[model samples]
Target: MTSVSSPLQRLADALRKDTVGGFLLISAAVLALVLANSPAAGAYNAVREFVIGPSAPLHLDLSIGTWAADGLLAVFFFIVGAELKQEFVHGELRNPRRAVLPIVAAIGGMVVPALLFVAFNLAHPDKIGGWGIPMATDIAFALAVLAIVGRGLPPALRTFLLTLAIVDDLGAITVIAVFYTDDLSFLYLIGAVVLLAVFGYLQQGRGLAGALDRSALPNWVVYVPLAVVIWAFMHESGVHATIAGVAMGMLMRSSTRDGEHESPLHHAEHMLRPWAMGLALPIFALFSAGVSFSGFGTMLTDTVSLGIIVGLILGKLIGILGSAWLTTKLTAAELNPSLAWSDITGMSLLAGIGFTVSLLISELAYPAGTVLEHAKGGVLLASFTASVLASGILLRRSAHYRKKGVPAETAGRE
Candidate 1:
C-alpha cells in the first residue's frame, strides 16, 4: 500500500533536521576513527587509498579519499551556495542593517584564527601554510550542537549563528579558491566559466512563466549533465572541483515568478539538501576523519597542531564576540533585543567547531606525513573541545529561558 515516494519523502524530512544530520556526521567520523586505530586500520587505509577512475584525457583517476574531498564535498558546497544566494536575495543579507553584525563577526572569526595560526608557526615556516585549517566553522556540526542544547533559546540567537556561519563559509570558499589552487590551467578554467554562464542562462528560464513561454526539459536531464561537465573542467583546471558547485549554485535564479510558491533556487536546494546531508557529508567524514592516533600526544605538541587548537578554540571565541561588540559600539547596529551577551558568548564558542573544511585545508597545506596527521588530529580535538564547552554554556542558557516561562519570540523584550 505504500507509495514509492513516501519513503523518500520521509527520509528527506529526517535529513533536513539539523540534529539528525549532525548525529550522522558524528557517527561516521567516530566510526572512521575507530576503524583507523583498531585492528582494521590496514583495511581502512587500503579502502581510502584505492583509486578507480578513468585516466584518459582528463587524468581523472583519484583515490577514494580524494574523491570524497574533491567530489562529494562539492555536493555539500552546492547546498551552501544555494543557501547563500537565498540569503543575499531574500534573507538576512538583503538588509545591510541586519547583515553588518554577522558579516563583521565572520571576518573577525577568520582573521583572528589565521593570525593565531601564523603566530604559533612563526618559527616553522615550513608549517605556516596550514593556517587556513582553523578558519572554517562546520555549519552542520555547529548547528547540530546548537539544536540539541539550545532548546527554548531565542530564535534571534539561531539566526545570528546561521548568518555568521554562512558568511564564514563564504570566506572559507574564497580562501580555497585563491590560496589552495596550484598549477592553474587557464584553458580549462575558461571552459568552466563558460559552462557556468550557460547554466545561469538556463536557470533564468526555469520559472513557471518561462516554462510557459518555451518547451523546457527536466532539471536532471539538462542541468545534471551540464553541472558534471563544469565540475570536470574545474577539476582539470587545477582549481578545486568544488568551486564549480558554488558557482552554479550562485548562478541559479532566486526570485520566484508569479503563481510560484518557491524560486528555482529554493526548489533545487530542497531537492538536493537531503543528498548533501544524508550521503555526501557522512561519506566524506567517513573517509576524511580516519587519522591514526598512533602519536596523538606528540602530535598535539607539534607547532602546526598547537596553532590549530588555539586558533579554533581561543581565536574564534575572541574574534567573533569581540567584533560583534565593536560593531555595536562603532555603528548604529545593535544586538537583537532577544539576545544577551551570554548568548553571543556561547555562539562564538560554538563557532569553534571547525571540522569539514578544516580537514580539507589540512590535506591541502601538508603532504601525507606526520604533519598532515597532526593537523587533522588538532582539528578533531579542537572541534570536540569547542562542542563540549559550547554545550555547557548553551544548556545553562536554555534552562534559564525555560524556567522563565517566556516565549522565545519575546524572551528579552521589555
Candidate 2:
C-alpha cells in the first residue's frame, strides 16, 4: 500500500471483511420477488409506481422504481468512478504491464457476451437494444462468493478479479451512455461540461481550502452544489444521470500529500461505499428485481431472455478464460504463481453473475410490460445459475489448497 492511504483500498478491504453487504443485496432482491409473487403483489406494484413529486420544470417527479434506478444508482456510480480514479492514479492500473492482462480479459469478457446476445437478438431487431445486458459483472456478488469460497486461494487472484471487474464496469457505463441515450441536448451537455470543469478546478486548487473548516471544504462548499448541477444538467442532456457520477469521480484528485491524509477522491469513495452497498444498491435491487412469476415460462423460452442467459453464463466463461489464456501464451506474462489456472477458471465463471447492471440495461432496452418482465426474470435466473456453478468450483478448489497446506499454484501443477 502507498503511504497516502488510499480510501478506495480501505473501502475494498472493509467490504471484503464484511460479506453481509452482498447477502443484504440478495435478500432485498429475494424479498422483492416474494412480494411480487404473493397476495401482496398489488401492494408491491402500488409502492413501485407511487409518485412523490410535482411534474414541472425539473421533471423530478418519478415513480419509486425510477427513483431507485436513476437517483440512488447515481450514488453507486459515483463510488465506482472514485475507485477507478484512485486505481489509475495510485493502484494497479497505473502500471500498463500490470493492467494489460486484466484489461484485455475484461474487453474480451464484454465483447463476446455482447456478440452472443446479438446472435440471439439479430432476427428480433426490436430486442437488439439489449445486447449490452449480459456484458456486466456484479462485483459485489462475485467478490462475496469468492471471499467465502476461495479464501484459500492466493491474494493475487482477488486482485485479478477486482481489476477485471473495474474494467468491466467501465465498459458497461460506456455502453449505457453511448448506446442507450435518447434525444440530444447539447446545451445542457455543454453546461454540464463547464460545471464539471469548474468542479475539477476547485478540487485541484487549495486556495479556498483555508477559507472553510477543513472537514467542510470537500463535502459542503466544493462538491455538493457542483454535483447537483452536473447531475441535473446530465439528466437534461438526454444521457443517464449516473454517468455524471463516473465523470466526477474520474476528475477527482487521488494523489495526496504526506502519505497520511486521504485524497478527496479517496474520501468520497470511503464515505459513499457504505451508503452505496447498504442503501442505494439494495434499494435499486428491491425495485428492479421484482419480476412476476407470470413470465417464468416465457422468459425461459424467449429468444431475448435466452440471449441474456447464454451471454452471461457461457459467453463470459469462454471470453474471460480464453482471453486470459491467450494473453499468457502470447506474451511473457504468466498466471500469478500464487494462483492456479483453476482459480482463474472459477473467477471467470463468477464474472457471469451480472445482476445489477444487467437488470438496469434490461430496463433501458425494453419498455414496461411483458418483455421487460421476462428480461428481468432471465437476469435473475442466470445470475443464480452462475453463482451456484462458481461456488461449487471455488469451494472445491479452496478445499484442495487447504488440504495440501499450499497455494493452488502447486496443486494445479500436480
Candidate 3:
C-alpha cells in the first residue's frame, strides 16, 4: 500500500518546483495591481501605510510597506547569500576560468544600465539618483519564466543565468549599502560586525562544539535569537537591515563536516527558501507593487521612468550579451558547449525582469509621491515586457532543442 503524503509534505514538494513559487509571485503582483487600480485602492493604500512596532530604543516602528521591504525581504536576501556561498565554494563560481564570463556579464549588466539611466536623466540632474533602479534581476521571477518556457534548453544556460543574477544581486546590495544610506552610526555598525563574527564562529561549530562537548544544541535555540539581535543592531546602524541577513547567511559554513550530509548553509537554505519565496516575497510584492497608473502616459514620458524602462529592457540585453561575446573573443573564456549565441540572447532578455529589488530601490530613491509611483510603473512595465520577449525567444529555442532530441527534463538540472 502506498503511503499518502501529509499536507505539509505536499506543500514542501510543491515549493520545490520553480513553477509554483513563480506562479504565486505573479499572482500576488497581479492581485496587487488590480486592488491598487480598482475602487479598493484607498483600502489597499491604508493597509500598506499602516504602522506598528516599538518606537523606543531601536525605533523599530515603521509602515507596513517598510516592514515588508526591510524585514521580510531580508529572508530573501539570506537565500541569495546562501546560493552565493554555494556557488563560490562548490559550484560554477569555484573555477575562475569558467566564472569569468558570467562575472564580466554581471558587471556589464549593471554598468550599462546605470550609464543608460544617467544618460536618460542628464537633463534632470536631480533624477539621476534613480540609476540603481534597473541594476537588479529578480531571480525568482526570471527562474520561474525559464521554468515555464525554457524546457529542453541546456542546463548550462540555467546555471549561467543563476550565476549572473547572483552576481547582479551582490552589485545591487553594494549600491544600497554604499550610495543610499542616509546616516552612518559607527557604534551600532561595530556592534553588528562583532555579532556577525560571533555568528560565523558558531556556524563553523567552533563556539558551540566545545561548549556542549560535540553534542551541540539545536540551531533555532542558538541562532534565531542571535540573528534577531544582529538584525536589530544592523537596523539601528542605519544601514539597510537586509544586509545583516546576507552577512549571516554568508557566515554559515558551506563545507560539510565529516559524517554530515550537507553543510549548515545548505540546510538553512532548504528550510528558509519556501518561506522566503512563498510568504516574504509575495507580501513584499503586495505592498511594494501597488502602483496606480492614473497618469500612466505622463509616467512613461517622465525622465526617471523612461530611464528605468530603457535601462532594464535595452540596457540589460546589450550589457549582458555584448559582454559575454566580447569576453569570448578577448579572453580564453568560451561559451558553454551546450549553449549558443541565441540562448545567451534569450538569457540576457530574461535578466531584464527586475521586480523585487527594483521596487525596494524605488522606495529608497524617492519618497512617497508621484515620482515613486512612476518609478514603480516603469519597473512593472519593463518587467512585463521583458518576460514576454524572453518567453518568445526561449520558447522558440526550447522547441528547437526539443526537435533536436534534447530531453526537456534536463533543462534546469545543473
For every model shown, the clashing-pair count is: 0, 0, 0
**Root-mean-square deviation of candidate 2:** 5.3
- The lDDT per prediction is 0.86, 0.80, 0.84
Better-scoring candidate (TM-score), 2 or 3: 3
**Mind giving the per-residue lDDT tens digits that candidate 1 earns over 200-239?**
8778874653562255555677788899999999999877
Task: Compose the digit string of candidate 3's lDDT tens values, residues 9-59.
Answer: 778767766677777777887888899999999999999999999998888
TM-score of each: 0.89, 0.82, 0.89
**1 or 2, greater by TM-score:** 1
Q: On a 0 to 100 scale, what is the lDDT of residue 24 in model 2?
A: 68
How does model 3 score by TM-score? 0.89
- The candidate that wins on TM-score is 3
Q: Which candidate model has the greater TM-score, 1 or 3?
A: 3
Candidate closest to the true structure, highest lDDT: 1
Judged by lDDT relative to the true structure, which candidate is superior, 1 or 2?
Answer: 1
Better of 1 and 3 by lDDT: 1
